[model samples]
Target: MSKLIDPIASVEDDTKSPVSVPSSPKDSPRTPIVALKHKHEDKPLSRSSSLLDMLHLKDVHIPTPPAVKFAPLNVPRHRRLQTAVVATWAFMIPICLTVFYGSLIFSKWLRPLAVAYAIWFVLFDRAWVHRGGRRQEWIRRSAFWKNFAAYYPITTVKEADLPADGKYVFGYHPHGIISMGAACTFATESTGFSELFPGVVCHLLTLDANFWIPFYRDILMGMGLSSVSKRSCRSILKMGRSICIVIGGASESLYAYPGTNDLTLKKRLGFIKIAIREGASLVPVYGFGENDIYELLPNEKGTMTYRFQKWFQSTFGFTVPLFHGRSVFTYNYGLMPYRRPVTVVVGSPIAVKQIDKPTDEEVQAVHKEYIEALQALWDKYKDKYAKDRKSELKLVD
Candidate 1:
């Protein structure tokens, strides 16, 4: 049986001695990859040479890490105890709440509501701020979500018959709190999005407040994401072929708990108008399991959380999505909710004719078309994605 030996001990040669072998053109030969031997020399081979011989490979030595980079391992004696204390306290709230209400919140409807509370925040609960960090960098490649994929697993399905020829405006609906899956797949190319939709460049839009911050602003930019403003929409649609907006804004996220699909878009018509103005086709995408992943504290339409979010929005130009998910400790449950599989299904395209400044009648006409398109997508995929859905799609003001 071959036991694993520490290579460090055997290769700890302080001084690298010269051992002559097939040489460079100026000496003996060029190199193993591209070489012609001229002569050889006699010298003592080190243990590294023996290892190379066993591996049947030429010696292409690499240096060790610089010594100045590492300091002696020194940690406080109470460090482990401190970590244990912090972890216990962090898990205390969930444990208490689990024993208290986890049993009481069991009804079909009640259970869903509890689930909602777990995934959401009550306006003031977002732990971090989106300071408009780097977006373009995240959008490019090798992003945080790519690394995070190992934990928060997600899959993207883009199947709409998109024209490989023109620009498009994709309107994603029912933005569950933070729309984590959509944000990951659309905003970052890490989700294998580009490979799914060839020839199409997608830009996901977020709130302008996200861009107001320093680090977050760059993060957002690196992801090719921008504000969901008219200026942003118009510029993006005008710029190229693909841009997406989480059609259901903050209000949508608030109502995103499973079994209760309430949308606040009856009065929202800006996206439709932009579609008309830009003449880009409309593609509706719905992410199943988006709401099931997190249970949040209740924030009904008239609740304090809801009101606070509106106030925050009016004051700062953007509202915070009060949300939660699996805690760092628990794997199956917590304030953050469970890790559920989210499947985003892309629907057929709704072709639109571009207009510079459409009149009220023109906008309304396009709006009707948009509704049909949205309805078509819902009707086609409702059963496939929303197997346990409680009700049919509704268009309420």
Candidate 2:
């Protein structure tokens, strides 16, 4: 049996991150090992190495010796702490911004409008940033680090174990409240994505409606985000290096209650079918804390929230992912999740032999294997991140 690895605690659980410069192996005690099976025919691949090799994916390494001289905000701990503060500070934005403009638009009488504006940003603006006018390349990159600093900080634990030449389909599970961590970590070159996982380029997939947002549309394109539409998936898989999809989307968001591992996925198979057609290896990813950040209203099947979301989906083709966190004054920790740690483990890849469109059984079989891969990832890393988890993982229908 392969023993699982708890990424967070396995390494220094409380160690602060090193910023800017990458560390040489000598400065660090633990280094990225290369015991992977590169010999192909002659030798068997080491579990981690061989798995990564098969999918054309690579593990990330956390730089050590803390590059203090080159970076000011380089420490990973600061990144985590500051991220919460920023989310809280963003609450102050409408006050400052509105005060600046309200005086002009409404004069001395409507000064409180600034607060209203900030509330608007929190309640409405954050679902996804698709505003139509701004230049987003900078935001995509900066947003990458901003989020990295805010939530779970990750590094490629090892080198790329896959062939330098190949294509892939990366399936990210447990679509956290926003799948925001996935966005910052994989979709863009920011947060050292390429530095961590080289050889394969990743395209983060999202809703087709997102393309309608003005500025956000430009931003996502630059980050290489594509539509989650089946046609788009086929095109992306054919394009080849790599592409990522949240797999369980809006519907998944409804099951965001804490202490549970219900994945609002089972019937969703367009991405999997696309993968079979493209002949790409399937990679399973599970992010701990994806669901723990906020307390969502109970939206069970017959609840008003659930009914509304379903109606909304039928009418708009998109369902409302209802969740709640904090509001500046009302929430001390705020809707912004507290500083609990979130770790995203990239599981070993499940290789797919070339084949035609998969049959129902074939799809179910692949999905079953995919679920196992995801379960293994959880089993391996759970103790580290979810040591306090109330119950073992479960696959809720």
Best by TM-score: 2
Q: What's the true lDDT of residue 111 in model 2?
A: 51
Clashes of each: 50, 15
lDDT of 1 at 218: 48
Which digits, one per residue and each the tens of the lDDT, describe model 1 over residues 87-165? 4433544554564365446566566665555445333323222222234543457634554432345677776656567
Off by over 4 Å in 1: 1-139, 147-152, 320-323, 331-337
Instruction: Please write out the lDDT profile of model 2 over residues 1-397, one tens digit for every residue.
Output: 2343323312222344322222567765676444333333334343333344444333433333222222234457755455654464444444444545755477756556645654564466532323211324565566535555454443322212544466677777678677755766676544566665667666787886765543345456666677776666666666555777887787777776766667866677776777777888888877777777676767888978889998888798767666666432333324555445556666667787667857998888888888877787888778877777767776665
Candidate 1 lDDT score relative to the true structure:
0.62
Query: How does each model score on TM-score?
Result: 0.61, 0.63
Model 2 stretches astray by more than 4 angstroms: 1-160, 189-191, 327-334
